[model samples]
Target: MKYTTDDVHNRVKKILYGLTGITLADNKDIMISNRIDKLKRDSKYKGDIMDLLHLVEEGSYVTEFINSFTTNKTHFFREDFHFLDLKNRAIPQLAKSGNKINMYCSASSTGEEPYSMAMTLLEVQDEIGKKLNASVIATDIDTNVLQYAANGVYRYSKSSKEFPEWIKPSKYFKRRIEKNLAGEEILIKVKDELKKMLTFQVMNLNDNTYPFSKNQFDIVFCRNVLIYFSAEDQNKILKKLFSHLKIGGTLYLGHSENPQDLVNYVKRVGQNIFIKEKEAF
Candidate 1:
């Protein structure tokens, strides 16, 4: 059955608002219809459009629907320059400050960004060794992806091939001795040293209560996740992120995201990078 663009928009608006507390406006007709068509094809729904809408409207299925519609296109070192900045400037500066350094990867999907962060810290291990305490908390809303992240393994053929060999799991991780019931080999082993520095958890940015402390982090990498949020939500999240950073902590956004004249506490540093003003805390 065919759906008018309005039907698609109404259905999707209800679904998104229920699942994410996000309201997709009525103007999003074409985009919503396109997304629903894709979802229909992906889920193999053989019935009418109304039936598909029913599936989406059922609140129990919204999480899977959100994951299906959301984009998760990250790879090892997708933002290469940020790592360079982290190595040359961020970590070095933090080392001398005599503070425990906590960095958060707020939208870490599939583990590449946080693991890449671990690798960068290892590169500067000699200078940063024991001078600065470090911990990385990687959070995402999708539990399926979080499991993959917690496992710290990837299909080397997809995202890891372009990374230098020294950072690949082969340099550190040994193949796990156990197999899933499928009897297929799992493809990763994170070195004990790097693995110790990172943790993965499920966090929903839309929630009113954050699980972390205020003024607690030295840096946060919440990239590529804000594009889906409305401007109002983005502003709210920026404020929340700022509240969690120390006086001079830094916040990194995706190349496509901007603070839109909303934040005064963070000053532009490098491209797509912002440093919290020393006075903000």
Candidate 2:
């Protein structure tokens, strides 16, 4: 019952790695400890930290344990280039071919990214005057974030932290401004159209097999998540994402992510954007 901080930290680190495949450096003691403390307090677990750790090891709070360590930071329209391609290229190609447009947000986070994708798809559909059936599959490893994402309400402020700088509330959100203790807080709720276009699920990219059919997606956004993985994992995920993507489907990575291993399988079409080559299989 009296486990040291080191004992708690090491067990947590191992559990996080086993469940999510995210490696935590030993120097992340403060982060691990802080998160564990928060989990104990928030989970309302009567036992001490070690007891909670033991529960996690035996799979009681595995989801919460994994959620504690996984970073879920995301933004709407975080990168303009990706959406621009969706608006200008992918949507148009699919529309003209009379094919249903499908997209996957591999790291959808709290829904901003997938909501952004939905907005673009709908806008493109409207502009082209096509009745293209379009939908987005949003998946995240963290159930907590996924719940928030599915709820789709936010406290909008001047800061770019919660809301994006360029998203127009008139287009995709039901705007409501109210004065709270913190002063005038703009609460933007996602429109029903955007909400209906997305389906969120819990997923771990580390899994060898995914619950998707081969060549099912026209575009996939695995952005910013690849950097957290090892080199071998990055390659494995890339290959899997490519396999799930249709020939000529698009893949978006983070700006800082190095995807040199995919040089043979994809063609670089834009900044951090790659089009799955037909020869990729």
Candidate 3:
């Protein structure tokens, strides 16, 4: 059995933060420690807790550690009103130009949020009797989760169960069946239409410069992630995200995030939603 002490936990936390600019909140040591212990057991790592910490500090097995430590909690139609706002408010305005709509979903975990955006785009275009020609870029720091997102499969008990009620899921998803030597498994898979609308990539928000061109995205969703950073870091990230938004593009943040500091650059258009400001559009 493997166990981690307070010192071990602190060192492990520091290692993960240094690698991913994402910090665990206070009082999360128990959860971090448990995951570390699980790693030790699963890998059958011979090193004790402190020894394992040093290995991680020296950048050995760092990717696995980072993958295990990062939080990737998300679901379809999360913060439902954001998608509603997209369908009823933002998309219509964006569709006015008859140009392709571009959306960015940062910290997109396992595809749900971006896919939700795709579903909304599909729904709105159908209602208006026009193809908005929209696209979604879904990004995350965890390679493991990104792979899962690109695969576009979800368990029936989890997100798949909720897919049907949203718009017309049949247009975007299909039943997936799998058979293996060990056993059989069943899941729902995203159809090509939805997959074609999304491009999944590995992105770390901590980078000083993002890969996106300035004023590139028509809608941005950077939800449920700012809580992990310091206030200063949060401001830095928000400014970068704002730079990527077109003048009238909408930005959706986590419900618990504090965006009061960004008043100079953005105005609140809805709950936890802001539109970039230039005083022109």
Candidate 4:
């Protein structure tokens, strides 16, 4: 049996929407099929390709597709300079405010960005000296990635090999073998300090309203993911994100993306960085 491309196209769209609320564009056949093919291979499907399609029709396919489709490219300190800027500028000013500082990682893939953020806050722990209470809320649309983030483990795969060792755990991570869901063995660990400050959740950026309101965040790192969205959707997301940021809070975008062309809500801070100029609350 053979599944027509159209059969795959429709099924894949439904699966993406149901699992992650990601609505695939009609023209995304190649992308969808490519992801589905990867899932088939990962699942070790022993049947015909059409039979594999039927398995997808039975549900649980969305979970498998998410495991394959969601991009998880990240590392321990991919952009060390960004952390420097946070330490030098953002953290100090927020500490002065004497408010409980909140940071959000919007596209926090595989946990690196938020963990880096936690480490930055921890770096200033002595300086702030009880003046600031901080927590990093990391959210991603992919539950599969979120699971790995929650586990706080890394194998230093090809995606993460380039990660600089300077910021690597100082007497923290200790490797220990553990069994996976399939009873396979692997080793990984993260520092207790880093683990305590960060929390990961499954969140869709396109959700009409963020669960938390009151414009509470001091910084929101909504990077890279918007490149995959349409212009209208991107604008919608930015507007929603702005409503959740503290008045003087900053929003970080991908290296190549800009919010300037889209709205006047935030003032430019630096490269792909924007600050909300509407008086702090």
Scored by lDDT, model 1 comes in at 0.75
What are the root-mean-square deviations of the candidates from the true structure over C-alphas? Answer: 4.4, 2.2, 3.3, 4.9
Per-model TM-score, in order, reads 0.79, 0.92, 0.90, 0.78
Candidate order, lDDT descending: 3, 2, 1, 4
Counting only residues 3 or more apart in sequence or on different chains, how many pairs clash (N, Cα, C under 3 Å) in candidate 2?
A: 0
Better of 3 and 4 by lDDT: 3
Clashes of 1: 1
**At residue 267, what lDDT does model 3 achieve?**
80
Off by over 4 Å in 4: 1-3, 10-31, 41-60, 126-131, 156-168, 175-188, 260-262, 279-281
Arrange candidates by TM-score, descending.
2, 3, 1, 4
Highest lDDT: give the candidate number. Answer: 3
lDDT of 4 by residue, 1-281 (tens): 56678986787676665555556778877777788788888778866656665676677454666677777777765566667667778888898878888999998988978887887777776556754588999998777788888888876443445444444454445566676786745455778867988888888886778888768799998877787666777777777777788888878887766674334667876777778877322
Q: What overall lDDT goes with each candidate model? A: 0.75, 0.82, 0.84, 0.74
Over 13-86, each residue of candidate 1 has an lDDT whose tens digit, in order, gives 76775566566665766667677777677667777767776877764455556766555779887778788888
lDDT string for model 3 (1-281, tens) is 55547677778778877887788777997788678876786557886778777887887877678778888899888888898899999999889999889999999989999999999999988889987788999999888899999999886554355654557665777977787785766677999988999999988888898999989999999999888887888988888888888988888999999664677768888999888876322
Clashing pairs in 3: none
TM-score, predicted candidate 3 vs. hidden true structure: 0.90
Better of 1 and 2 by lDDT: 2
- Candidate 2 Cα deviation (angstroms), residue 25: 2.4
Candidate 2 residue runs with Cα over 4 Å from true position: 1-4, 158-167, 279-281
- Local accuracy of candidate 2 as per-residue lDDT tens digits, 180-233: 797788888988978998999999999988899999999999888887777887
Let me know the TM-score candidate 2 reaches against the reference structure.
Answer: 0.92
